[model samples]
Every structure is written in C-alpha cells, then in structure tokens.
Target: MTQVRFMNWYLKIAIGSAIIGGGMEFFMINTSFYDKVTVLEAEKGAYENSPQSQAMREALNPWRNKDTEATKTP
Candidate 1:
C-alpha cells in the first residue's frame, strides 16, 4: 500500500510539471508571435507610405487621372 501511494504521488508530480512546462512554452510562443506580427505591421505601414508604393499605385491605375480630365470644360 505504501508503494502504491508513492507511485501515485510521483505520477501526480510528473503530470503537474508537464502541464506547467507546456503552459510556459505556450506563453513564450504567443509572445514571440505577437512581437513578430508587430514588427511586420510597422514595416508594412512604412512601406505603404513610401514613394515607391505611391509610384506602384500610379503605375497600376493609369486611368486614375482621367476623371478630372473628363469633367474639364473643353
């Protein structure tokens, strides 16, 4: 009966430690992912506001200026 009690205690400790370790790992991974996403968002915002992005937009939409021309009195 004593051996059985000891075994039960050992199993409980093992399971508890495993759960704690998994929780720590999950927290670390989520923190890392959040940091990465933040950095990427900042970089994306910077790129979108740059001249290169504006030039690309103009190049992609060549007819963007035609509306003003069409409304002009000739």
Candidate 2:
C-alpha cells in the first residue's frame, strides 16, 4: 500500500516561506560586516610589525590591552 502525504497545504506554505526567507538572508547582495573585517585583516597584514599597524589595531580594539605580538609573549 502507498503512504499518503503527511504535510498539508498550510505546512507546505509555511515551509516554503521559511525557505524563501532564509534564502533571501543567505543570498543577500549587500556586503556584510564580516567582509569589511576580512578586508581590515588583510590591511593589518599589509602593515605587519609596524607601529602604525599597532596603533590602528589599538584604535580598532580598545577593549584589549596588548597587541598580538606582545600578548603572544609570556
């Protein structure tokens, strides 16, 4: 015997709506905040081992006290 469909019309519509909503968010055309972060990280590497880079990092992350190199040390 064949089994009948468990999902009803409302359920399917709800699932479809949820999928489209999620897709809209996931496939957004806008550049995200993390994209800016990745670009800033690349810039950080561009200024490697420099006082300017240290100053920029400090200005960016004021909550943190020490720089990466300094924190890496004992």
Candidate 3:
C-alpha cells in the first residue's frame, strides 16, 4: 500500500513538472523574452563582429539612413 501511494505521488509530480516545463517553454518561445534574448545576442554579435550586425542594427536603429525624394512646394 505504501509503495503504491509513493508511486502515485511520483507520477503526479512527474506529470506536473512536465506540464509546467512545457508551458514555460511555450511562453519563452512565443513571448517577448525570446525576442529580448535574441536581440541581446544579436547586439553582442554586432559588437564582436561588424558585418554580421549591420542588417540587425539597421532594423533596430531609430534614425535610419534611407533617403526620401523631395516633395513639391505648396
């Protein structure tokens, strides 16, 4: 009887851990934390290597370099 109760407890804990882990993984991958980590990694990469970061920097930079054509005077 004791052995059976222990097994049940173990099974419940294992299942609960699995469910929580799955949820955490889903949240981490689908939420802003993932993007934040990716951005940090990209920034680190950009600091270590220039060429690898150029596109990422352009994508994140506020003051971009793209030119706009002149408009007609009103």
Best by TM-score: 3
Order of the predicted models by lDDT, top scorer first: 1, 3, 2
lDDT at residue 66 of model 2 (Cα atoms): 57
Task: List runs of model 3 lying over 4 Å from the truth.
Answer: 45-74
lDDT winner among the candidates?
1
Model 2 pairs whose backbones collide: none
Clashes counted in candidate 2 amount to 0
Please give the TM-score that candidate 3 achieves against the real structure. 0.51
What shift in Å separates residue 48 of candidate 1 from its native position after superposition? 0.4
TM-score of each: 0.50, 0.31, 0.51
Task: Report the lDDT tens digits of candidate 2 across residue range 1-74.
Answer: 12335456667889999999987877654547568878899887878778887888789999785576687998
Lowest summed lDDT window (length 10), candidate 3: 65-74
Which regions in candidate 1 have their CA more than 4 angstroms from the true location?
1-31, 68-74
lDDT of each: 0.94, 0.77, 0.81
Write model 3 residue lDDT over 9-64, tens digit each, in one string.
99999999999999999988888788899899988876867765676777787466
- What are the per-residue Cα lDDT tens digits for candidate 1 across 23-66? 99899787797788889999999999999999999999999989
Q: Candidate 2: misplaced stretches above 4 Å?
A: 1-7, 33-74
